[model samples]
Target: MAFDSSDLKPVGARPPLLDYLVSLWGARHFVIYDARVRLAVSQDHTVLGKVWLVLNPILFGFTFYLIFGLLLQTNRGIENFTGFIIIGFMMFFYTTRSFVAGARSIANGQNLIRGFSFPRAALPLAINVRQALSQLYVLAAMFALVLVVPPSERVGLHWLLVIPIFLLQTVFNWGLGMLFAPLVHKIPDVGNIMAVVTRLWMYSSGLFYEPSRFTDNATILALFHLNPLYQILQMTRGVMLYDTLPSMEQWSLLVVWAGGVWLLGLIAFWRNEESYANERR
Candidate 1:
């Protein structure tokens, strides 16, 4: 596992791993520049540019509203279906994009893989950072939308829970991305398969309907609570809708799951790091 100096094969003025890490840290400007350009390119070429950030979750919220709010009438007991859906969808999208987009990052960066010798992992990390920042735009729109359409209960101090929740979600996203990195790199079709899986995941995560609304059976309730996404969403709903903190059990589960997933993904991705630069799609 050691990078022996004698064993190294230099590429251009390629720095040592430690030096690369240090330089990468100092290259904050490069990271920011790359992030800004990618964000702009991804946004500008589209019809609405940055507004699409707002539009995506809004569109999803309205669609869920029609299905769960009206058709199924799943808004029972709890109030403010719109706020509920908005928070849930926006947060869930973070995980979904991480899963789908992160899955393809290596293959997508094929050119960089062939051309550059810096941390191959940075490419994926950069994508994750870019997407995370994009989520803030959606968060802002969520606040504005909720203000105009005011939820039944006031947004309380518990809304601040979003800070930690997002941090946990980001780590979880990184883990998911790393875990999938090699899979997509090898099979390619796994990326397409993940897209379908994530859609199914959204339906099951109570993005459209609250899991609690479905049933009271112990087995069914247990199943819903066990879903990590459900656990995270439950924590979010407790904060935003009820203005209450999650139970200690919920917080514990979030920490355990996020930590476990992240470690697993990091190890999985690192194991194959040496192959990434040479792999052909």
Candidate 2:
């Protein structure tokens, strides 16, 4: 068995950034198709099926309303606490699901990764889309419920701002998903750690209360503004509660982090695409 010198060729330099992005852009069709297919199968055999999306958030909202709005008396002077909590819970949960679900994407889909040859990022993209779609039903139902509930606010086009906010949040979620895939694949315990961290994130994100209430200390107030999750929740709150545009500063931070994470995740994930199918814990 003799090895030939020509057969020992070196790998070429990585593809240019523009070229890589173009390839991803061209692969959008596959991403959409996969997203739809996975979305369909997500509730294939379930009894409640898609209704779970609507039901789950309402249930959680009730729990929060009971504990925070009623029992704990944490509402302070905020108006329409129920509707406020509902919006925050639904929107934040969407991203939480995408992050936690995507953590296992590479490890659990060994067969697909091994058998097929497509953009690996598509798996997380599909997961993100499916989760977002599932959660959208919750968003609609929550707004509708607010119409009937005694303390609920009336619907208006101002809430339409949710459209752009959600779209941008989706980009941020996908970026995170991209980053988590490889790290979780390498460290299986990252799954448990992420769950705990997301719980802390949920509490700290001020989904249940207004961050504006925290003005006791300069550092604390500044910390709330700098928190990315707080910024996102603020954006959602602006559209759903105040019917106003998000602050320029908040939007700028979200854009930077979203774009930076997306690029870093793309390069990181692509670097591991060829090995994903074979590597395991």
Candidate 3:
């Protein structure tokens, strides 16, 4: 009276990649529900509640405008510096927040990880989803600022491109979060260093000033061009502020970046799945 144990696997073992992906797909409903609940409660402790989502970006835009636009005169040649800075800060924060939150998701969710035997990637994925939901309010506030501020931009067909650009950026953000979650889970200190790194990234992405104004070096310029966030802000500005369509080249680069990072990050995160639950202890 022996049982066939060949098909039996240990609990908490990592599944095959394809099976892992399928399991994740099957858990989409849980992910969405978790994201929704997190988004709803994210600001509950504050008096301003969800208003902070919109107000935070508005404040960031104002601070940058004051420092760079009014004081430093970085807005010198740009026609609509107000709109440019708003788009840059609002859009860039979406990715930055996602990256930081995702990087810390594993460490913060140790309790849940210990309690459940689910795909480890779900924590970071849920963080990205919550950020995406929050970005909707940020986007509304951004559009309002660009429309009402002096030198207002007109709405055009090109503006519709924001939807796709945002979607691509979300995917990129998810990938970045997944890429760093494991590292942060292991070292913990990488999370501390990310603040400075992201600040440098913000500057390099040309959030407050035009990169071309300061650098004439072809290599530096090309590096900026290759930066996905740079391309995202550029394309967003092109459509939202300039009423121009992003070139095919810009679109291609973004697609490559988003897809490549997503694939790479998935592998990175999934490879260490079994270790996540154990390491957290």
Candidate 4:
């Protein structure tokens, strides 16, 4: 008796896009569990344990505040510059960590990729999820610092806006990770380049100084306005520090960026699915 072969596909063949998405959705439980497990053990061997998650960013923020706010006087005209820098550093680091980890996911997970037949995208998705989980503690530390630091900010209804802003930034970070995962996998050197790139991004993001202070050029200001990370930082500062709601323009721009990058990144990452398993072999 002959069996029908029409429905059969090669073992490693790439699935259609919709099927790929469904498969990824089906694996959501695995992704969440993997993220939780990794997050739990991430600092196991370190002396400080999970405290480092909150401490590390706090230390960085303090150092920057000392140098820029105190010594350099970049905080000259800005109100509550301490809180501004803290929020920028913590939030920006969240994306930086997520992007770098996602970029290295495929290269680092070669063992699992070769051993299993799961959706390749899961690797990066898991990495971003792990970062997002870790970020929660970091954010809590940030808020505490903002409220307790010398020049304290008051809690208000505007602070509620942080929830949506954070969710958008998280989605944007996932999209960014997906966007670069394939490139880094294909060219491992991209990982090194990303380090320098992220540094430049941090500087350009107005982490230590206000952009308006040094520039009046519409073109330059527009470029900053167009940056999604800049928008994220600004919107976060508006609600958390200034007790003001973000403008609708800021909201619209961020929504477009988060949605556009996620859609494009998904397609880009998915197109390279079949190559992932055999790329460097």
Candidate 5:
């Protein structure tokens, strides 16, 4: 058997990166529709429907406050520990959810990838889209909680900065999904591994507690500063609580992480585009 043909293209061939980007742009409507459908399907079984979006996090915040604030007194040094806990958990979970969904995007959509000819990046992009949309409800709940709870942050120009912060985080999530998708596709069980890994990342990312607690140790403090998520969290707290912009240090780290990861992920995932078409279970 011999085969050498320049005229034949693989049936599932992915176009060049620029072509792929153009295809994704063309498929933007599909992405939006798919994301909305997924969110609807996710809530299909829940009796409370959209209410769960607001209720779930509210309950989680109350539980954390009971243990960390009321019992353990984790709020001792903080003025608005109530808002603190909510912001930390809510903000951090956005990225965590993005990671999990992105990791599973390829594996879960293997059927679509094999059966369809669209850009594979669409799947991961849709995951981030779904999350960002859902956050609309969650953030509303968070803001309401902030006002009713102690140490209220008045609404002003500073609060508006959260919009950009969220957009930046979404970019970061998009990159994360791009980075994790191919790896998860190569190892299906890597999805499960990432779950545990992100759990650890959650704790280490300064979502559960303030980083100031570690001021006594330079090493620990520096470690927190290095985490892009922690940087976002600290900046978010400052905005919502104090009406301030991110310090120059935080701004530098955020931009570098978001842009750098996005570029890297785009290239890395593009390299695997053709391979994705053949990845069927």
Candidate 6:
């Protein structure tokens, strides 16, 4: 009560964009280190444990292959159909889990938010890291599937592109987490709606059918390009399975989604930082 105004930390004071980013950069270790620890803790409860990371996507691909590739002959238009399905489904799952995690991050971390004084951004950062780390196993499994599956494709320099592709997706997911974390924190029901949104996203994202199938319909094709998840999955499949560079259009879309969403998310999330501390219910 005796302190001057300078000593009083304003409740809910948001840092400028540049300074907020600097703080996040400085806290990168906390994000990564804590993520690793939490990743382990997060996995301990499940019976199948981390095995599900690799198994789940592979199983999903099998279901898609059974219906689309084998029954409906959706793969008729595409070469290396096995490899294509594997890449599309597995990679799409990464972003799905990332968004789900990000959407739930803030509301789930209320205890920490109420108790700690550290960076609120770190929670979303950690969620992305955890998702990415879990994905490493799945990525490895996908490569193995590519090698063993039909229409065998050789691994080459382009295979190395998975690293950058994953990096872009990770950043994109982090941004999404930032954008939704605050909103969901404020409104608990948003989580239920996000579940439906994610399902529609997966179905429309061309996980099994090639986007080229829609080429006759210019409007539909154009809409597919607008979906960042679709673009990223297309880009990943092009490089890893097709052994060709992604079209400039796909690359540009991924870059824009990754950079634009992450920047917007950070700003939005930070703007509400003060409220997180006092949020109840």
Highest lDDT model number:
3
Q: State the TM-score for model 1.
A: 0.88
Candidate 4 lowest-lDDT run of ten = 272-281
Report the Cα lDDT for residue 207, model 5.
70
**Which 10-residue window in model 2 sums to the lowest lDDT?**
7-16
Model 1, 75-175: lDDT tens digits are 88657778788878888888898777777888888887778666655766777788888888987887677667765456667678878988888888878
List model 6 lDDT by residue over 33-58, tens digit each: 98899777775788987787788889
Residue-level lDDT tens digits of model 2 in 59-170: 9889998998898777897777877787778888888898888767887777787776656677887788788877678778967876777675667787777787777788
Per-candidate TM equals 0.88, 0.88, 0.97, 0.97, 0.93, 0.92
Q: List the residue pairs that clash in candidate 5.
A: none
RMSD, candidate 3, Å? 1.1
Error of 1 at 178 (Å): 0.7
lDDT of candidate 3 over 1-281, digit per residue (tens): 99999999877788999999998888788889999999999899999999999998898789999999999999988869989999999999899999999989988999998897788888889899999999999999988888899898888777889999999999999999999988999899999999999999998998888889998999999999999999999999989998779999999999999999999899999998877876644
Select the stronger candidate by lDDT from 3 and 5.
Answer: 3
Measured by TM-score, how close is model 3 to the native structure? 0.97
lDDT of 4 at 28: 95
Query: What is model 4's C-alpha RMSD?
Result: 1.1
For model 4, how does the per-residue alpha-carbon lDDT over 87-145 read when each residue is reduced to its tens digit? 99999999999989987888898898888888988988998889989999998998899
Off by over 4 Å in 6: 46-48
Q: Which window of 10 residues has the lowest lDDT sum in candidate 1?
A: 10-19
Which residue runs does candidate 1 get wrong by more than 4 Å?
1-5, 10-29
In model 3, where is the ten-residue run with the lowest total lDDT?
A: 272-281
Off by over 4 Å in 4: 279-281
